[model samples]
Target chain A: MNLMLPDSGLLFWMTIIFAVVFFILAKFGFPVITGMVEKRTKRIDDAIGAAREAETRLRSLAQDQERIIAEAQAEHGRILKEAAEEREKMIVAAQEQARAEAGKILEEAREKIQEEKEAALRDIRREVAVLSVAIAEKVVRKELSTAEGQKEMVDRIFDELS
Target chain B: MRKMLVIFIALLTFMAHPVFASGSSEGEVDVAEMIFGHIGDSYGWHITEWNGHHVTIPLPCIVHSSTGWHVFMSSKIEHGHEYEGLFLAEDGRYADKIVEIGPDGSQVRPFDISITKNVASLMFGSALLLIIVLSCARWYRKHDALEKAPGGFAGLMEMMIMMVHDDLIKDSVGPDHRKYAPYLLTAFFFIFLNNLLGIVPFFPGGANLTGNIAVTMVLALFTFFAVNLFANKHYWKEIFWPDGPIFLKCPIPILQVIEILGMFTKPFSLMVRLFANIMAGHAMILGLVSVIFVAARIGPVIGGSMTLITMVFGVFMDCLELLVAFIQAYVFTMLSAVFIGLSRQGGHEEATHDN
Candidate 1:
């Protein structure tokens, strides 16, 4: 009987004790615990979010690197090809100029050789003229020993001259 | 967990058999008095009887009668002695209560607010509960739970509190659980702490706190308010106009009456289940210990053998009561949360959500 029936005095005390426990716990105990847990959860979520953002950024950076490498490769190929073409053009232009210079030098040498031959011929001609004149004078000196012959020769020469 | 308690009891009943034998030299042991006195509340802590003298720690006796307030130590009225016209009632319906010879020549109960055995134990238990929990809470305040996990006693307490709140109370109390969590959590750990303390056979324990109806009643009342007071319209509607056949609701309101009766019955069951479970566990262990004493009347052979057998049974029962302690606490807290959840639902949602 005493076991089942509730006592008013104990009930009163239990109520008071319970109220005290509940009040203290509700005010001091529970909030801080749950708050810490809540704070921990939020912190974890924020970390995950930041990690995901970093991963995306890293991926994009890798992509940018790849793109830049490809562009540089193409630019390098184009510049190398242009240099090859310029080298071919320069070699052709130099060959043509060298051939023109050789032809002009040959023509000047031929003309100078021609001028020296003419000068040599003219000197020979002068020496031949002096020698013929000296031979004619010797023939005349020999004929002059004959005075009478000289007079006849002089009259014929006068007629011929006229 | 109860190793200490069973060992102490073994030392008392087994090693010192003749003490009980000589203690009961007057006659056979009063099994009812022994069992009831162990389970029941008392004005003093009966440690043991040494050299025919009761070694007791007298508690304070505070009583208010029709005369006035009378404050005294329970020691004054020990061993049937009278103090200030008041004494411990030995017989009648008011047995063990502090009563006075009234104007009617019969005994009358005073408005007693004394620090009796159970009350003192409850106080000690609650204070200890605060220390264990508040210390764990101090760890939470000192260190950040967000980055670090709890360890040692703090870790154990955190795990337990989480299990009670998250695994049990959180789901049972539904969406608005946070609003009711404080009271529910408080009730839960209070019962759990006191129930554990009740199993310890020595100081700071050995008193039935949660097993007492008054304590359980107060606990049940906490759930009752958490349910009925904050309940939505659906709760009342379910009680008065539960979804049922036209005949049950319109003609006699039989189903509705049953539904309404269930509201009170639910909390009543919560109260009784906790009280009976713990009370029965204590009774069983005490009964087993008393068995050895009762059978010792036959012979020393029977007594010694029964002592061994009863020790085994007592240890087994104490272990069982230890399990029952946690289970009963969980059951009460879970049920309270469930009742709150049931009441706080929107109207007609039960019809839509079958689960």
Candidate 2:
């Protein structure tokens, strides 16, 4: 038997069958498999991108929180400083008012003392004048009783007049 | 076990008759013929022998000739019988083929289009491949979105298909490989399935489909068409007039002729390489088995020991052939991809240079 020779019948069958198989596989089989693989790859990539975006957003939010806390702390420091300054101003004004009130009280007290000393000196001068008048009246009554003594007193008075 | 031993004794007695009848000058069973017969294609499927009876499944014999179409079962031509001017020729130039007796009693060869042994096996292998591949495709379609990873038969088939696409086609054919992926995948799986089937020494498997030259030729032809059909203008330019100095072209243009011949030789080697490897593997197995029968001619003692030894060696060779089956299929597909890839390199040179 010639083993190498090709049989016409078998060749015809082989060609037809192989062609049918090739077309069927090319049309139906390959596209589905490749499509699934591509889809899976795309899904994984999208998931990774979303995760990275979320991470960045979280980081930014944390930064915003830190900034807000720092601003609040600075505002608190300013309010405390303003309160300290206001307290110092009130204390200084109260001290100045007290000093002015003490000075006015001292002046009033000195003026009253001087008035009291002048009144005391006037009363003493009145008492001395009354005492001298009473003494002179008593002495005149004694000299009239003695005529001779009275005549001598009249002559002395006339000479003083001239 | 008793039945096997009865059959063995029957075969010995049957074979001994010829030696006794022929005066014991030489061995009765022709080893070369036996080997060739086992390797050759036939018009019937040989099942087994039962009580000196040859049990076979006869196929249909269809022929077209100058007269008209002649269709009949192959059994009509059995046992040297002739029917409707057709018979299996046993002598001369057209021996072992169905021929018609002309009006002058001379032999005339008709166009034989019979479904021979190899044809039946091819059909069987094709059916098997279709079942496996189509089922995998359907399963992938149903659970494609839900199932992240392939499972079961679908998983196995996907791994192999991806290997062909990524490792074989993409590596060789490059970026435009998607267009050619289907054809390459089909060719690889088809050849691989047939090779595996040919190793099974039973029904639906024993016929040497890949070992047949016509089958391998057809496979190679597909690759040839794919390579040339999609080839761009630059491919032809490189082949007919390669880029070289003018002085090199002046010396008889030998390079151009060789380049042109290389195109045909590429596919030719693909065809012959697969055919020869598979055919030789089968022949080697058959030759190993023949050692037992040959040893029997000396005596039963030697023959029994030879049978044991041959069985051990035969099993080893069978394992080797299994490996060879996969390797040959891989080699055929790989070379086809490389050749097609080479053809695709035509228009990409400038694009690559720009990059």
Who wins the lDDT comparison?
A: 1
Q: Using alpha carbons, what is the TM-score of model 2?
A: 0.75
Kindly list the per-residue Cα lDDT of model 1 for residues A1-162, writing each as its tens digit. Answer: 798988777788888888897888877787667667667778989999999999999999999999999999999999999999999999999898888888888888888888887888888788778877787778777777699769978998999999
Per-residue lDDT over B107-183 for candidate 1, one digit per residue giving the tens place of the 0 to 100 score: 99989998888888888887887777778788888996888978899888777777777887778877778898888
Residue-wise lDDT of candidate 2 within B199-281, one digit each (tens)? Answer: 77656676788998989989999999999999876788888888887666667887787788988999999999998999898
The positional error of residue A25 in candidate 2, measured at the CA in angstroms, is 1.2
Pairs of colliding residues, candidate 1: none
- Model 2 — interface RMS deviation? 1.9
lDDT, residue B207, model 1: 88
Q: After superposition, how far is residue B186 of candidate 1 from its true place, in Å?
A: 0.8
- For candidate 1, report its TM-score: 0.84
Name the candidate that leads on DockQ: 1
